[model samples]
Target: MGSILIKDTTREERERIVRESLGDGFDVTCGYDDAGIDYQQYIDGKKELRELNAEADCGFVVAHPEEQQKGCNNI
Candidate 1:
């Protein structure tokens, strides 16, 4: 119910915001980590959510493949 801007929130708030927004959506595929988004920057107040989201939408993010999981389809 308040501003989530880096300057408007604390580190803990930023952590919660990022986690809640990305909850259950983090995986080897299509994940912020795999997409090379430094979400930690947001938590550190060095970057904003919009910055990260923009990177994800620009279609130019580098992909880092994760190791294959045995018997795991992420289901």
Candidate 2:
């Protein structure tokens, strides 16, 4: 797995940057803004968005396994 940090930008801009950086080969997944007002209307909104985007755009889903497993022994 690989990761990239994007800062100092609007949500749309960040999305564009991530899309451009990812290029046209591998699938892309965005794991930012889960339940923020601009993202979605529910918790786990990030996952929901990822699924929607992956289905509609054929991009890979983005997720932080370490973060998700921080309090668990599933790693």
Candidate 3:
């Protein structure tokens, strides 16, 4: 399982995709089933990601700023 995308969908549609893509829904919503998790932060981060994607589709997103062969050169 490498990079993937399931673009443009509502929450219900995302749920269906989760059920199909992963038998579990851990990555579908803002929070996973963890005890004492700061759910507000999780939700806020998810919102931020959505806003960023909306702004520019995050085409400029990067994990590495240089080509030193560091981590996850995947994109």
User: In candidate 2, which residue ranges exceed 4 Å CA deviation?
Assistant: 1-7, 25-27, 30-75
Give lDDT tens digits, candidate 2, residues 1-75: 222222334455545545564465523343333322222211222433333443343343448755664544221
Backbone clash pairs for candidate 2 read none
Model 3 Cα lDDT, one tens digit per residue, 1-75 = 421233444445544544564466355445333332322332333433333323333235556668556554333
Among all windows of ten consecutive residues in candidate 3, which has the lowest summed lDDT? Answer: 36-45
TM-score of 1: 0.59
How far off is residue 55 in model 3, in Å? 22
Off by over 4 Å in 1: 24-31, 57-75
RMSD of 3: 9.7
lDDT of each: 0.70, 0.38, 0.40
Clash counts for all predictions? 0, 0, 0
Off by over 4 Å in 3: 1-7, 24-68, 73-75
How high is the lDDT of residue 32 in model 3?
A: 33
| Model 1: per-residue Cα lDDT over 1-75, one tens digit each | 899899899998988877787785553233375557778888888878777766654455335446645653232
